[model samples]
Target: MSTIVRVAARGDGVAEDGRHAPFAAPGDTLTEAGEIIPGPHHQPPPCRHFPQCGGCQLQHLDDESYAAFVADRIATALAAQSIDAPLRPTALSPPRTRRRATLHAERGLVGFTAEGSHAIVDMRECHVLHPALFALVAPLRALLQRLRPKGRAELHLTLADQGVDLLIRGRLPDGLAAAEALTGFAQAHALARIAVDDGYGPETRWEPQPVAVTFAGTPVPLPPAAFLQATAEGEAALVAAVREAAEGAATIADLFAGLGTFALALPGRVYAGEGARDALLALKAAAALARRPVVTEHRDLFRRPLTTAELDRFDAIVLDPPRAGAREQVAQLAASKVARLAYVSCNPSSFARDTATLCEGGWRLDWVQPVGQFRWSTHVELAAALSR
Candidate 1:
């Protein structure tokens, strides 16, 4: 008999001896034959799509097991680099908390892609999307049917402060006829804004008022398709962790800052550096409006990370990088004289790798906060504090 000990990184359950069992959860029992016996941690999935949706894989596991899986992923990555730190209990956003999602449309169906296939799930029900976002599905389907689109298209939905922001890709919205259709759709839905792109770039179709995203109690212009944290609760959790790490610093540097998520929130002179022009401009405008002491810079950190000598000017540093992680920047930071460092990451493996670089430079992990932003999915996020 093989006992499933825990869930692996890709949503598979691992046996005590490290064998693989598909769709098995922790505490499950397997017999001599290849069969997954239900376990205490396993439960019926709530969403009708379940394994077919590809939006969520761990829906079969209960809350405890799911949260455990999130923490274990971070631990496993840290252990790879011989790093250990006390981790807070995983903070999980509840179902229907997702504020941003990309849905595929094909064969007159609109929803998430089918598991391991290009086929569309045609979402009649979704437990992952916010109710407001989900409510747009039926209307979207009707619009697509009426248009009779020739091929594949993608829909990106984001909940801005004003209302839902919709961006459609892979369809031609040219001509007076198509323009009228989109205008009617936007007005009917009372959407905050609608954008259409045909492999070139997003062009705004309709926007009545300026759409913005309130971060850390300040309203910042929400640039079209700008990067945003997926869930509101998840963003709050990460912000809290960042604040704790950044406490007591009179001057803090926010590396890779996106629209001042932390720069505007941190209570000090903030130096925000980002590569995207629009994001930098938005952060600058918000900082000016808030009258905060925030200095903005347009920098490509990947190509030109701040040097060690340049880094020593700040008391603390906060960097929230993309999935590829900030290896180059971490290397420079490792050799810097900066005292406190807070890192917010979406990829554990990359975070662990970069952390090893910092540890090698005599830095130590202070603490870790594991976050499950996208619930029931294998994706994991974390915020960590480090010191010399």
Candidate 2:
């Protein structure tokens, strides 16, 4: 006996079967049609493995569709705070934006974990990596299997235009031999450089050569591990947006400035502050080389925040804080004599909190635009321009 049970439907069209009737689920494995059609703004179905793969949450849709989904999510978050501004919709350039990735090295095999599981998938090719590095996956995996020095370890691999870096983890049976194998692999593969972090003592310092990217007919050399936007196109757009907003502003303060991405791009003298000594040193030197006027100060803005007195030194400010927004600093900047403040943030929740504080402190939200830098993930970078 076959009995079909019908569940109550809402305006959203979601049914009890957890499927939408109008929109069929993406794969051929599904026997029933989904009740909810993927909306114009909804993420499309691409991979059968959706929400499971921690690697890419938005892989279910094509690049353009995915970018819209991300933009809408950012819009919804911002609108909750009464911020009604035009969103700059952008397309995602998929299939090669990932510069660094960590792979699990198992018994005689090396690969990434399967969707939703730590179980390693012995992958011959990764769709997320650049073609040059993607083509080397098999050979690199074979090299790991032959070396077989550690037990259930992970390989941290970073690729740039200059070379590749290999940071090995876990216990290795042979230390020196493992190093030799890695060195040999690099030489044979024409990998410009190779490094090993065998959990040996302190963290090894890897000063990678500058990676070159063209912007406005100028070649920008970014430090290897410094904070550059994930995608090349995204960085260009973000830099242009900031430059346009800050064209004639004199004396800018770049808070949470990692390698002076905004500070160096801006004209006139800029004061930059970051918590990391290495990043600040590299940024200061690079600024000098580029003939850009940027003075960097290594200070922990989190623990001890910048005072209003310090904020008064700059006529304008740009803040690119981490996931945790610069709450206190935003309030301080709002109270200071600074006329305009541009905030670039990745986390909307933190941005909302900080925006509320700033608004109360006398700053008005002028506009916000979403930057779809990290294409496949739920994370969206936002650039907000505020004024007094």
Candidate 3:
């Protein structure tokens, strides 16, 4: 018998001999016949779509085992670079807390894609979405049934300060009957806003007023399909880490700052550089209206990152980059005079690579806070602090 000692990066169980087993838990034992014997850490998945759903990869593990998995993801990433730091306990969000999600729709089917397949799950129940977002699913199914030529589309759902803001892509509420049906659907459900896109761009078909997201005690207008942290708990964890890292700094440069997630909350003079026009304008307007000292700039970091010479002027820096990570930007930061830095990332592999670059430049890894925002999934996020 081979005992499963750990989980691989993609959620498969690994034995001491490097043999891999799917759906096996950390303590599970594999028999010579290649069968998984249930272990103490293995729990019956709550979701009916568990093994088939691409949305999650670790639902079979118990709570303690799941938490360990999240923590190990960060620890392993750091160890890969031969770096060590005082890592705080990982924060895990509860199920049904997801504030934003993307669901697929085709013909009469609606839900997430199947694992490793394009076939739709047609969700009858979802344990990951906020109740409000899930509440729209049935009605959305009805609306799609009424207003379509039986074509494929996508549903982008986000719970805003006002209510659920929905965007449908690849199709629209076409024709007068379809348009009327859509208006009735939006009004009946009392949705905050609804829009459609036929590949060109999203066009607002209905809006009660404005949609916004409240972060760090401020209400920032929510742009269509704007980036948002998956869960409220996850956002709080990231923000607390960033605030602790940036405390006492008089001036801070927030790079890749999407809609001023940190700039709106941070103290002192803050400059935010974003690549999205709508998000940049929204952040600027919100800052001015609230009389906050946050300046916004529109620049593509991938094309031209903030130069080291320019980055040296700030007392501290904050980086919240996409999953691809900020290799170029981190390279520039490695040569700058900034004393403190906070990096929030959703990809552990990418984060490790960039942290190595910063560590090679004499910066020390102060601490890291792992967050399980997408609960029961292999995806991991973290907020880390570095100092000279």
**Best by the lDDT measure:** 1
Ranking of predictions according to lDDT: 1, 3, 2
Model-by-model lDDT, in order?
Answer: 0.92, 0.65, 0.89
State TM-scores per candidate: 0.98, 0.80, 0.98
Residue by residue across 99-146, what tens digits does model 2's lDDT show?
A: 667778787666667655887776654556656656667887787677
Off by over 4 Å in 1: none
For candidate 3, the per-residue lDDT at 206 reads 88
Cα deviation of 28 in candidate 2 (Å)? Answer: 15
Compute the lDDT of residue 366 as modeled in candidate 2.
75
Pitting candidate 1 against candidate 3, the one with the higher lDDT is 1
Each candidate's number of clashing pairs is 0, 8, 0
- Please list the residue runs of candidate 3 whose C-alpha ends up more than 4 Å from where it truly belongs after superposition: none
Clashes of 2: 8
